[model samples]
Target chain A: MTSAFWAVYLREILIMKRRILRQSASMAVSPLLYVVAFGCALGAAVKVGDRSYLEFLIPGLAAMASMTQAFAIATEINVARFYFFAFEEFQAAPVSPFSYVLAETLAGVTKALYAVLIVLIIALLFGTRLNYGPAFWGALLLNSFSFAALAVALAMLVKSHADQSLLTAFVITPMAFLGGTFFPVDALPAWASAILRFLPLTHAADAARAGAFGLPPSPLPFIILACCSLVFFSLALSTVKKARN
Target chain B: MIKTESLKKSFGRTRALDSLDLEVPEGELFAFLGPNGAGKTTAIRILTGLSFKDSGKAFVAGVDIDKDPLKAKRLCGLATQNVNLDSELSVRENMDIHGRLFSMSAKERRERTRELLELVELWDRADSLVKSLSGGLKRRLMIARALSHGPRLLFLDEPTVGLDPAIRRRVWSLIKTVNQKGVTVLLTTHYIEEAEFLAGRVAFIHEGRIVREGTPGEIALEVGKWAADTFQDGVLKSSFFADKREATEFLAAAPGGGTLRKVNLEDAFIHLTGKRVL
Candidate 1:
């Protein structure tokens, strides 16, 4: 399991290693602009909690970045299946489907970590500092794992590159904007808040916010995240098995 | 090293393999000849564990495929019809990834990578990305990567489907060399010349069943030693002859023009199945 799963994960890292600069640049561009435009326009004046809006926005962006970067693996998986035939190679090899999915999920998590770094850099340039502790990282990892597993399940369901792009546009994009990234779910209308509370990203953002402020997050969000991650993980594994044979 | 019995597979209403049986002795170069859309690719998929057999048994190097797919897979190396190498990675990285999938040690990966790259004559291109390679070069690299783990059985599915004649012969020689090193090879090819030149035994499959199976010489003998083609009534018909002396006399005594040539595997296939091997 170690060798085979690492083989798949290491292959992605090896490829990413060559294009690390381009990847970092791409990740940096959006967060950089968001920080400058949003932070300058309204962030300095508004305060989400004990910190300025800019500092508050840092954790939100961290959550969003992890979700987005981790979910980005859907496109890569589509490319491997449709264009490069690399997924078929894995299927034909001696590696188990579970290891392959786990390796891909780890790759997605790795990307999320990189994106977190990029967002943190943007926060530093703005002189916005907050708690960078284990709790913060644990919440961040949970968010990435949940979303990356969802990405793998979605990749298996999608049949074409166009469908993959559609998912990014319709599902991921809407969730990034509406799932408590810009405003707290508690701040929404009572009826809207009821529905928003159920979104995984909403819990992710809330938990991550608590971590960034050096406060202990409640166990409920982590429990919900664990459940969602397990569901997505199982679905992805079964879908992958179905696709192979 | 490879055997399947009563193998059955289907895609919707389309039956890909219907009670198909195949056997290849250790170190034998076997070729499966069939037209497009036949069960050739499907059968290979099941044996290699890329796809499942509906309700039959397949054993690879004594490992039952459906029962122990990983063990079966570990015993064979499949270079599929399509070049499936990671185009973004360097040639050596592609080989390295495969070695790691088989759980080879670091030292073994290094040594095996060198050995395979040199064997396929791609050692110089080891650091180059796979996307940078020409079609012929990519084909060779895939073969090298397929052989990276040194499995007892090698499955080559149309290894030279689109290459030019010169490159095809180069690949053919490479395959022959690998087989000579005691690797059992189960290959499929559209080129009758390829099978005739490389295979120790050949099987012709059509509509998911083996229509004929035998040595190249033995199969070709079904259409006799010589063949005469006559075009009349806007249609071409072929006649086989066992005696060359009689065939010569038969062609010379013809009142109308016709062509006579040596009976080959393609002729035998056409005569038996009413379909050309190509």
Candidate 2:
């Protein structure tokens, strides 16, 4: 059983390697511009709560990269499986539905990992300082996997590429903006804050910023994100098991 | 060996596989001949455990598909109609991954990759990206990849649909070699010539049902004894025999100027399935 899991993990690594080879240039351009646009220009003009714009927007942009890359990973793979090759290889192989989904989710997280590392390095080059520690790394991983699972689950349910864009535009973008990525959730209305507290990214962004600034570690956000991950994972697994019929 | 008993599948309101019954004996090259939308793909997918059957049972290598689908799938290899390989990887990489999926050790996987690539005459091109290879080379790679784990039974759906004649012949020879080594092959093809060349026993499927099943010769005979005609001086010339039995009688009765040959699977398929091979 452990061997099977490793095989799935290695396959995911190989898949991500291929993705990086194919899209690294395009991916790098987006994050590079974000670093210049928000971290430099916008940082000079605005104050996010009490922190400088560069200090505040840096963690949020990093989290944004994590979410978009995670979602892209799942959506593109699902499209390739259904429309490009029709997933014949996976279907004929001994790998179960759960294993296939697991591989895809891992691949998605890897994409987010790639995007985060690139953006983080660029931020550091531009005079942005972060408190790097184990807690920060842990929080980053948590956010990547949570968003990947949710994205894959959503991909399985939708039927068209245009629909996927609509989902990202109307759904994921709103959450990123409102999930305390750009600012603290204390500024939100009471009802919105109550809902944001349940969101994985809200906790993810909070955990990330807290760790980056050398603040005391808190378990609430991790607990909430872990619960969200569990829900998303189960939903993805069941969607696949049901969709095959 | 493979067997399906009253296997049925439905997509929305359309009955893709309607109580289809199919069987392929051990060491035989069985062909599923049908037109587009004839449920040939649907039946093959269900039998290979790629799709679920709405009702009935499927077994591969004596393992019930529903009860032990993984076991059944492990016992068979499928080369689908579309070239479904990972284009990002090289030919060798694709086979290696398939080997890993079957849980082969690294050394064993490498060894098997060498053997299969050599068998397909693709060893020299093993490191080439799949997307870079020609259509014929890719097809050969798919066949080799299918055999990487030593599957007892193989499925090739429309194995050589759109290739030049020479390349098609190359694929045919490779399939024959695999079957010669005791692997049971279940192939689906729309081309009458392909089915005739590869299948020891052919089943004619139409409208989601097996309309006829027999050896190619038997099917030809059933369509009335087939006779070959030759052209001499731009004029058609031939001799007709009574049936499959009259081959000897006609040889003795008519001294050969040009010659007369027996009918082929193409004529039999047209007679039975009532569809062109296009």
Q: Which candidate comes out best when scored by TM-score? A: 1
Candidate 2's C-alpha runs over 4 A off are A1-8, A18-22, B227-262
lDDT of 2 by residue, A1-245 (tens): 33344555665566567766557776667667766776677658878766787888677777777877887865665666666563567667787777867777787788887888887887788888888677777787788888888887887787777788899998788887787776678778888788888767778888888888889979998887777778888888877666554
Q: Lowest summed lDDT over 10 consecutive residues: which window, candidate 2 chain A?
A: A1-10
Best by the DockQ measure:
1
lDDT of 1 by residue, B83-185 (tens): 8989889998999899999999989999999998898999999999999999899989888888889899999999998999999999999999999999999
RMSD of each: 1.7, 4.5
DockQ of all candidate complexes: 0.81, 0.46
The list of candidate 1 runs beyond 4 A from truth reads A42-44, B245-256
Among incorrect, acceptable, medium and high, the docking class of model 2 is acceptable
Indicate the worst ten consecutive residues by lDDT in candidate 1 chain A. A40-49
